[model samples]
Target chain A: MSSSANEAAARASAVSEMGRTIPTDAEVPHPEGVRWGMVVDLDRCTGCQACVVACQAENNIALNEEQRVLERRAKTWIRIERYWEGEFPNAKARFIPVLCQHCGNAPCETVCPVWATYHNNEGLNVQVYNRCIGTRFCANGCPYSVRYFNFWNPEWPEPMNNQLNPDVTVRTKGIIEKCTFCVQRINRVQVTAKTEGREIRSGEVQPACAQSCPTSALVFCDINDPESAPAQLAEAEAGRSYTLLEHFGTDPGIIYLKKVDPHAEIHEDEHAHAGAHA
Target chain B: MQEPVVADTKTSNRELLDFVFAWPAWFFAVGGALNGLLVAAFVVVILMLMFGLQFLGYSHPVYWGFLIVNFVFWIGVSHAGIMVSAILRLTQAEWRRPVTRAAEVLTIFSLLTAVQFPLIHSGRPWRTMYWTFPYDWNRGAWPNPRSPLVWDPSAIFTYLTSTILFVYVALLPDLALARDRAPNPVSRAIYGVLAMGFRGTTRQWRIQTVAGLLLSAIILPIFVSVHSIVSWDFAVTSVPGWHNTIFAPYFVIGAVHSGVSAVVTVMIVMRYAFGLKRFITRDHIDSLARLLIVVATVWLFFFLLDFFFGLYGTEPAEVDTWQRRLVEPPWVVIAITFIICAYIIPVPMWMFRAIRRNFFWMFVTTILVNVGMWLERYMVVVPALERKSGLTFTYGDYAPSLSEFILVAASFALVILGFLTFSKLLPIMPAADIKEGQILADRIRVGRANVPAAMRE
Candidate 1:
């Protein structure tokens, strides 16, 4: 067999292996084209929260005041979740960015009575702000706890209000708002590509979180397109890639590359401790 | 069993119609107070509309709290009507005669109060039409049938409509009695219209009886399904503490437990308030207490099953949620209080005949049962949301705000106010039902004693 053919076969086997591990029910099927997804490299994430700030600014998110944070009602579309690996002397602070997975069979989509949240053709979980009646059922349905409720009318004081993004809707209080993978950017890129009579290039559409990540820990791409660099990278590093809460069978669009820990024993022990705590 | 001493038709009419004819001082006082609280609730709702759900104790993760608990609690209370009127009627339980109207009336008022919670609890209560109304014509989008929130309204509205019909059907003869006995031409005409031109005839009585029976049979499944659907609001969710298979039966049985206990509480109040010494006797209360013992036991069984099954899975999230409920400070206190009030105190005391027959003890204990049931719902709802997922960093505690407390208090006041208004307009206890029981009363001689007996159809 030719070397190119052998490499092609290896890629196909790796993709199949990833698919086999991620169990999906009949309700969720991989869409035929332009499936937008993300690959987060935990090894590279510095827990700086730059993506969180970028997401807030781009999405027109409500100002999460100190009081709101103290009350545990702060709305951050993307958050850096910090975990400690070991006790006291040997402790290692680990960071993982948590956001909406935009699942193929999204639990949030199914639970919204008014069809306020739904999966678009582009594999995007779209939330219609006007349609929501604030039942919060979708929030409870989500296993990831990424969905955030707007408890109060958004306030940006005087000058900060001027910085609000015109591209994104400022969600009113009482409705749910969550990570939409910066859909406004996607729409802009798609419309621009369509106007020029060309296909959207790989890596052309970048979410605010991915765009602002200084270390390039977050990579956004069209997962269905085999030619996409990030898609190929995910397949190339297939052994390390895993979805959040894979047991849920949500068929999440976001993939995470496991944090490379040199001390495997400490990581294993921490896993056991987390299991007991859970 | 000792046969109840049935009152004569004239005496029954005068006694049952007393509250309708005259204004009692306590009635005005209590009604005024409840009205004041309801007004406060209305103000809070208006503030919520203006300010957003910030008035609520809702936070990230713990999105639902007191209002949802009250919704479930009132829905549970509404089950009293079906359990007392329908189920007892189907079984032909003799003690159900005087208690049926009060229970059914409680159902209507409680349900009316219950439906309001889901509306007011929403972030955008004004836009609740999008959730409730059948279609969105502008968008050509219908409400998602897959959602339990959709099923909730369909189930609750059906239960409410059928319950109204059930009460109205049983109320016709009583309305006729009120029409004949009405002090003024205004009241007489009002009662006449409500009575729907019914005259005492053999055929009409037969049809009325059959209709009542048919409604009783038809409403039984709705009664069961209503609470089961409410249970699914939590159970169908992937939330660990709420996702148990036993939630349906647990909620249904718990509803019956709290519902019947509420019935007993209402019955005792009706007995003293209307001077209904003859109709709502100790024997009636005893029979209800006996029914409650079985219901409470079954509810406890279901509660244990839900708790046991929650831990049985041994999924970290599930175990963590249970731990929060069972071992955590405030939640542990609530769980203990719930067990004590819902089961420990009342069920054991109810096992004794003396305690069951005593109106004071029955009233206090039944009230305790409802308190415990409310807390039980709170424990089931809030703690689970506090520890919703394995991402422990996101876990949060919820404490209901002042607005939430006010709304919860007003719900009780609303049910009481509704019951009082209904009592003032019509007989709270059915005079027709009491007279019917009187006609059925018989005496049979056994050995040296003349035993009072019932002539069953």
Candidate 2:
């Protein structure tokens, strides 16, 4: 081969090696199988709302003032949705903590005009705040109704301003906001593990919601890791575990265990835990 | 041999030219007031953007409210220009001469108005420019092609550019006549430049005619694709009511129905405004009304097809949406009004020859049809999102706020302001085409009857 031709071949190889460093879908099958997931135990949840408070503090979500709530414009990244079961005299209230599901086949990611939201290799649905033009198509496409829009600029009065989490951005008006499973904490843990020259252990990353759950109802871990709590619980509780809106084929990462009640009737008219979804 | 038809067409040419040359004071007074109102509303909208969008009344499930509905409505209204001008011209309809210019102007102005909704509706209206443009050399980012919203800018920009060129190309001959008859040097200079040095030579006319025909042919498919893409904006989404397969044809047919009706309303008003009753005869109004009846029927057919698909489909979400829309309180009333105004009443009223010929009744019926079509857009956009499926707990209602109402009023004012300004600057009657039509439309006597025949040559 000529000298110039040999030089071109060497340059091409170097460029291809550099391309490998920036992860492509083919390069990153997540060889470690590090797919993050969550499991919510409906049987154990008492609807105390400690997780909601924790999420707000960790994510720097806007305040849900009384007037904003009255106007039905309140922004909440995670909230408890309550549905009543039967007749008023014998009614039972069910509470489900609804947040972004981070679906495997996310509808919100496809409809976004500017690609404001996308799915990452770790099975995480990431929202690029700067890219969003606030078309609100993503919010409408979300069947879970978990995405919230910042209708007004976030206000942090006096001393409460100091409580703001520097890790997460304080979104302004006209943008959609949603839960990220405490991605800041995830990044921090990954950074520490990398610096220490070690792989991240199972249960090492705890989202604020999971950590604050008083009854230990919420658990977050890498489903790809065989030793992870979420993976084992998802496998062991297969009979009782099912996803919300499985019929939609969203394939969400979050799974829920059915509430256990011996007195619950199985009949045509009355579904035992249908109220939880409703 | 000189055709007798030429003599008759000349009688109104002077009057037609005079109508545009003389700018009426009352028209300016009215147009200036509308322009002032539009400027005020725009200022308010910008101020609201800075403070927050809460004033628009958009909430969780009902995120797209009046802004989107107004967008679709104005775009549908813009469709009339293509139907009346290009479609009628290609078919060689003689009566199209007096009405085509007004309708084309409507299309241009309304489309300009419609493009604003997406910009203003953006949460970050300022950043929308960067978001839509496909250059990310610095950021290493590009707009997602998979998105229908990305497709919207390309389609609307193409439609706007082509329609503007179509209007200017067709206006050249008339502009030449204006340049020749200008009483002042300033008017002569302005009209001369616009005329682009046309010498009225046979070769120039031949080239213009071929270019016009070619442009009309190309614009036809783009017109169809533009609205179909707009419908896909909703249909591509998984929202229960919007995710139907029938949205494309339904929106297209509905656009024609509203567009043809809007042309009739404009023609009748122009007849009085320009005193061109002899030019835009009662025959022209009747033909447009007849065309409207056919469009309305086809629209009703598509509406029924969509209704049945939603009603009988086994999908629980689709069925629930249809049932709730009908049985629900305010929506039930809106549905009833949409039927009466869009189809039931206007269709029957347009059927009668006497009603179609009468200017007042024609005006009232066309206005009713537009009102009904606007409601149809509202019904399609708002209700689907209001009752979006999956989480029944989050389903809610939408009510347009005072600011939204102001924005709607401003959009209408902008359309009128644009049309009035164009009329003063150019001859809107298509005098040259009308003379051509008159020459071809000589009377023919067949046995016992005297009938008008337009010789194709």
For every prediction, compared with the true complex, DockQ reads: 0.41, 0.53
The lDDT per prediction is 0.87, 0.82
The top-ranked prediction according to lDDT is 1
RMSD per prediction, one decimal? 6.2, 4.4
The worst-scoring run of ten residues by lDDT in candidate 2 chain B lies at: B1-10
Q: For candidate 1, write residues A1-278 as lDDT tens digits.
A: 67975675566456446532111232135445578999998889999999999998999998888888988888898999998866789778989999999998788877888888877657888788878889998998898899999877888899999999999998888889999999999999999999999999889999999999999999999889999888888898886788887666788899888777687554676654443211
Model 2 residue runs over 4 Å out of place are A1-32, A265-269, A272-278, B1-9, B443-457
CA shift of B22, model 1, Å: 0.8
Local lDDT at A170 for model 2: 89
DockQ of 2: 0.53
Task: For residue A164, give model 2's deviation from the true position in Å.
Answer: 0.6
Worst 10 residues of 1 chain B by lDDT: B1-10
CAPRI-style grade of the A/B interface in model 1: acceptable
For B374-441, candidate 2 gives per-residue lDDT tens digits of 98998898888888885777887888988888889899899888887788789887877777777676
